[model samples]
Target: MREISFSVQALTAGYGNIPVVRDVTFTLPKGTILTLIGPNGAGKSTILRTISGQLSVLSGTVMICGKALSGLSPAALAREMSLLLTDRVRPEMMTCFEVAAMGRYPYTGRFGRLTAGDRQIVRSALARVHADDLAEQDFLAVSDGQRQRVLLARALAQEPKILILDEPTSYLDIRQKIELLSILLEEARERQLTIVMSLHEIDLAEKVSDLVMGIRDSCVFCSGTPEEIFAGDTIRHLYGIQEGTFLTRTGSIELPRTRGNSRIFVVGGAGFGLPFYRALTRKRIPFSAGILFENDLEYGTALSLAVRVHSVPAFARTMETAFGEAEKDLLACQAVLDAGTRIGETNAANARLLASARSAGIPVWRTIHEQD
Candidate 1:
């Protein structure tokens, strides 16, 4: 087993005498990533702040490398952990390189000037985050995403054993989000750095985290492996998501299913039906969908959008009974949509449904954009 890098024991943290999150306990093994997730105002940030020593712990303890946080000097703590906080930073007249170079303060001499090796480390950190282009740009002038990357580069320059981030991806686009997290993943693996961060993107968190901690109702709601935390209705209930469905397998969310009787029938499979289902849902057109295997990529979206759905076991041949039910639904509808599912032995029922729709004089559409 890997050495434990950080541990939180029955911690309660917040401002002043009040507690925002209580009884949060977890341990981070070397090179592991733990993510905190919850709805807004659930104290995810508070937990991070407390652990990073930016805020006082109202109760309990935080230990880094078996040493209590309270016992460590500021410089020692800085050497052990680095943080990228959500707090806005505006360094006047400083370039991005200067901002990032500040992270080496713990190792700098009294004069605090960067040595040649320190400068190289700063450059390497910027390159690691793909922010080398922004090095010459004025720190205050960069976009939020660029600033975030620079801040992360700064934290990396600290070369701490642990990294704590608060909503690090908040300002990042999808591509930047993936790139930044990928860098963190690589660093954790190669450097054996422990990572603790709070994220609003539960889907991304699920993908990157080894352990997931859910904060809710001023306490640690739950903590476990991603497989344990993301299973079933855990995510849905954690976020109090009543308006839509959360698909655990794909970590994708779908809007609430359209209510009332379905007027249109959609024949889709092999992950081709997702866009059509979403388009119909946006148009507020309640539709029925059929002949999807439980393992289909679009199955979750179909369940959330379609008023009714016909599905068979994953990897199993489409049952005749399911096809018959789908055919009946198709015949009752005035129109049918063929989502361009590939015709194969396993999904041959979809082809039959399309043919049946044509025979019944129900207009069959190859795409959602087709004219009536």
Candidate 2:
């Protein structure tokens, strides 16, 4: 079994005599990727700062590798852990390599001389971030994504057992964000590096981390594998997004809830439209269409919602003539009925279209709306 790298017990922390994090307790095992996720102002950053020794703990114990963290000197603590803060200040003239080399400051002598081993460590760190070619480029001149990778490389150079990051992907684009996260996961697994980071992107957090820590209402709500933390009601309460649906099979992205319409379909035509279509959208229901004229308003509305529509003649006037022209449309509705979809029509002339669906036992709701 992997050893526990960091353990927080009854930890309470904040700044200047006030506590933002209350009684937070969790143990992180070595080489595990743990993610902290919560709403803004939920004390996620406060907890990170507390564990990193940036803020003095008001009470309780934070143990790193069996040693009480509160008892360690600043230099002693630096040897065990490295922190990558969200708000990093870049040196105006330093190159990416120079910035990364700074992570070795804790291990260097008074003169800050880089030994052959130290130089090798720095070089490996740069390559880990895929930034070896940008070694001589000015840090301030690089894009936000490049700078972020450099900062991560710098932390890697420290060679600490534990790495803590606050919103590491804040400055990265979608592609860069995924690339950086993948790199972090790979490095942690390869080097047995224990990682804890805060993230606002729920999907990314769910994808890469072995454990997820969610903060809500000044308490630690839950901590476990991504599968356990991202269950349907867990996210609904965590983020307060009731419209969100967690896909059972996919297990990551939350889907937006689509309102299921009770009944709707039109043998499409022009000007015999607008009013009825507007009513359907306003009611927020599922709908279907068929036999539409090329320029029909009803056809346009159905297409917009991506409902299935059957194609037929551009015009149909009387019952016999229209039904004959719409024979294909009637058969197509059979597929919809097989799927148990409801059917309905607006005008009496087209009302017969609902008969087949009704004969198949699918419920039908009929109503008409006058356009303004």
Candidate 3:
């Protein structure tokens, strides 16, 4: 279990009259990586800036190590936390090593001479990020990904207990993104350092973060473990995605594309349709179903797949169509089957529909025995 560090209360700040971060409150515990995620203009960057002392808090309290951080000097704060923003402007003549060494300024003597320990710290930080080979290269000549890693190393050189990053993987290729995040995770685990970063890659954030804070409509709408925030409801609302399923495979979360028009009609109740429904979805085939009169495993599944539902009138005297509605559905399915569409059915009641399919020479699959 990690120790708790910062305890923020009703923190609010903005550029001017417009408040971006509106009355946000949260806690940061040491040895854990927390992620801030939301849409564009969700004030994620503002939160990072305010926490690192780059932007003044217009209201509320920011406490670090049980002390009020409002009046702390920027230099003093740097010794406690390091900030790595996305803004990249390389100086004309600075080498990668020189740029990374700038983090030592707060602890440097008046003469600005590098002590043996200072050089060792800089070297170690560069090596930790695998940026040591790029040390002698000119900052202006490096790629955006390389520059980001160098900056991260510089932050590491500060020896801060906490690290804050804003879109650290921005402008990096897929490989670089994974490498950079891997380095950060390693540092957090090895040194027991607290890390807080804002990210656009929701999937990556969910995978790496111990806790996730999501912003919506200028307020912190949700905050919890990654599993909670990345659940179907929370993720869909956060990203404004209308169609998709949150899948969990082997204890890992995935948001595979759920877009398609394979509207398969499943006819079964009492746990009969689960296997086919799951199989259709796994094979990227869209499906629907209905007429469930009571609680069934397939009922929840059909709802999850957004299947079209047509209920049968309960307390009916016979297992027959009500108000000719089921007859119309049968006709509709027959029309599709006549046009060479695939249809399936289960049990004795709907078995008539399958016989009709066979009569019309349409392929019908029976789940009477193999249904899960």
Best by lDDT: 1
lDDT of candidates 1 onward, in order: 0.89, 0.74, 0.73
TM-score of 1: 0.94
Query: Is candidate 2 or 3 superior in TM-score?
Result: 2
Model 1 C-alpha lDDT per residue in residues 147-265, reported as the tens digit of each score: 99899999999989999999999878999899889999988998898999999899999999999999888987788999999998988889888988999988888888889888899
Ranking by TM-score: 1, 2, 3
The CA lDDT at 243 in model 3 is: 58
Better candidate number, 1 or 3, judged by TM-score? 1
Q: Model 2 Cα displacement at 303 (Å)?
A: 20
lDDT of 2 by residue, 1-372 (tens): 779998889999898889987988888888889899988898999999999999998998999988999889999999999988888676889999899999999999999899999989999999999988889999999998888999989999998999999999896899999989988898889998989999998888999999999888887877789989877567657766655444423444323322453245544455344444445555664555554544454454444442445544445443344454444445444233222222234233354555665676545554343431
User: Candidate 3 overall Cα lDDT vs. reference?
Assistant: 0.73
Cα lDDT, model 3, residue 112: 69
Candidate order by lDDT, decreasing, is 1, 2, 3
lDDT-wise, the better of 1 and 3 is: 1
